[model samples]
Target: MHQNPSMADIKVIIPAFNEGDSITKVIEEVPDFVSEIIVVNNNSTDDTFEKAKKAGATVLTETRKGYGHACLCGLHYIDKRSKTPDIVVFIDGDYSDYPEDMEKVVAPILNENIDFVVGARKKELREPGAMTPQQVFGNWLATFLMRLFFAAKYTDLGPFRAIKYKKLKELQMEDKTYGWTVEMQLKALRKKLTYKEVPVRYKKRIGVSKVSGTVKGTIFAGVKILGWIFKYSIR
Candidate 1:
């Protein structure tokens, strides 16, 4: 890895699953201020790895095929590296997030020395019909319960978030399925980590979504996320 003298250092970790169509574009859209980009290919059936490599992102393959599994594999790679990162930014590979605003997401942690940052999305920011009714209701119900249980404030369980690498590791993130984002948020609150929210834009993705697409998928994902939130919030 090359060093930047300008002092703007960050590592972007993208977990991709069958996102070959837009992964390359997303990689290209990421701000160059980021020192490193690690893309974890979560058992993609397409050419996600090839496209990411073509876009100059360091790529690794995670055969287990879950969002949390892919992220954990990437984190393990980072942990094993000689030079660790100052911050770790987790973004989806589907290009729903505005890659340019990555600076905004990482700035609070970088400047104020905050421990973690979540990219919150307002209703207007979301693509029309981007979130299913179940998703919206699930977020509200889960977040309400979280606040009630742990007295912690949370706006969105967005996947587009960043955290200090050290503090992130200390949380011992263990979610291996669809509940990854919520698990991180609940654990961070329980651990009393300094976290902030930055409003971000969301767009329609290039391909189909695994969750929020089918009735079963939506219910299962919402149940898993809510279950994880309650499990940690009570602890």
Candidate 2:
């Protein structure tokens, strides 16, 4: 929080996977204050790429087919830019999150000089069926473990989050799959970065969830999340 950046330098990165049905809506809803919207298509078999581009977003493709891979691709693109962004906000492409709420997501970094901010989909604000039972349990378990092991105060591993660009690179984020979100949170804690959570509204996604909608996905995600938590605990 040493530097205060203008809203024009705030950029957004969205990782989309077969989200053609909701890509445009997600892109359109992002606040006008954002400087650029970069969408990384995660090997989508649908028209997510074309639609996002048509919606006037800078679109890139990552054929690795993982959430973390897509996010890393977007970060790579920004790193090579002539003028890097001051802040980077990440959101899902499924349209489950309120894109307009990005103002609050990035507010901590912008207004209060906080290092990181996550949009907590508070239970009261989440629509019925927006989160699967497994997802709820997984988030609870992950945050609970972090609190127990590190005295951390995180509530949810929510995807809608904002972070200082420099702080993000300092994390050296490497998880290329289900463990991405938790990896960021844990690294932030280990590094002792200032962070906060803002409750945000959530709704049902336009299409089925790739991770939470299937047994395999749910199990893999759970294992990855817990693995990160335990590994950090031992350290």
Candidate 3:
């Protein structure tokens, strides 16, 4: 069994876009084992950058206004560091996920040598009205399609996930928008990486969701996610 992660080189990357109201709480709740908390401000028109920095996290700016872009910017920042972390955890700054549960999310990777882990947001564990109807349907359709096409076993494309840094590098992720989460899962399947899903609690976010809250955002996200699935299915 993994004794403890306190000595492990673990880092967290949170992608924030106008999550000023929740970013600080998200940062503060992270487990102590995390060596560094990197919050990528995705061109937030609010005080996301200031709040994240004030919370004692390493803040980076990605003016591209995309989830993937912000995550990529965080990865680039880590790449420049002299010492690379052993594990990288990706979480959203919206505070929907319980940051304290990160240890459970990373346990499989640390103990069983799992290459990737997804924090499955089971319906029983989610707060009421935490996920929009579009979000729920989108997750079901996307995971079902992935299973049908790739024989994968994923329940949700939850943003709360952990992966070995080296395996993550091997994925060569390129999505710059809403397709980021699905792209990572698809790539993991293609690479035949050992993976697992751990149940995690989800709650309502502090601010409006940028993707699932608006009509255009919902449609665009649906298209992007489906587009990635089909594109990978054909390959």
Candidate 4:
């Protein structure tokens, strides 16, 4: 049904908010072989859009603020009225994820025909204090529950991930909050989609984090993520 030959033909979707400083760097690192790059500027107070546009990235704005909401906007753009790449790679605008590794993540999906892929950042590779104690425990509990209830296996719920566009659309993704990553993994598990994980180096992101810095943010994220996983299991 699609003519694109390999994952290189995929589009890179980066969700950014107030990342004016590092957006250009991430975009520049993306291999030239990529078909299209869309940066969803989620109501950035700074000149995020201008900088991304100048870097030759197709910039779109989502007034509402939320990681999942911004990505939903990007997906709508890609699904409804765009080139419709064979695969879609989601990367954060913070430049924490190595852009050069995009090829590494997508290769499994293209060559071996994996349905979706996640860039698993092992605990050993994660930087000191990169994950709060609460974060680490929450991830373990959540992944355990996912394996127990959904029978899914994933090490880290990292934002750096890739999936076939067709499978992505099949998921009918609806999370508009911090739980988006977990939600996607649960769906992939429930659907029994072929999945793979690759070793991706993790580093501190530019600027302060949005969800992990505050007590309220951390607790709310933990609650939302756990709630989504179980809620789907009952359905």
Clashes of each: 0, 0, 0, 0
Per-residue lDDT tens digits for candidate 4, residues 1-235, read: 3223342568989999899989999999997778889999999999889999999999999998888999999999987764688889999998778888888888888778899999987878778767677777888898888878866778788899999999999888998878889989988887888999998877778886778878888888998898998798789
By TM-score, the candidates rank as 3, 2, 1, 4
Provide the lDDT at 205 for model 3. Answer: 91
Residue 18 shift from truth in candidate 3, angstroms: 0.7
- Tell me which of candidates 1 and 4 scores higher on TM-score: 1
Maximum-lDDT candidate: 3
Clashing pairs in 1: none
The predicted structure with the larger lDDT, 2 or 4, is: 2
lDDT of each: 0.86, 0.94, 0.95, 0.86
Off by over 4 Å in 3: none
lDDT of 3 by residue, 65-173 (tens): 8999999999999989999999999999999999999999999988998999999999999999999999999999999999999999999999999999999999999
Error (Å) of candidate 4 at residue 163 is: 0.3
Clashing pairs in 4: none
Candidate 2 clashes between residue pairs 3 or more apart in a chain or in different chains: none
Ranking of candidates on lDDT, top first: 3, 2, 4, 1
TM-score of each: 0.94, 0.97, 0.99, 0.93
Q: Which stretches of candidate 4 lie over 4 Å from their true place?
A: 1-8
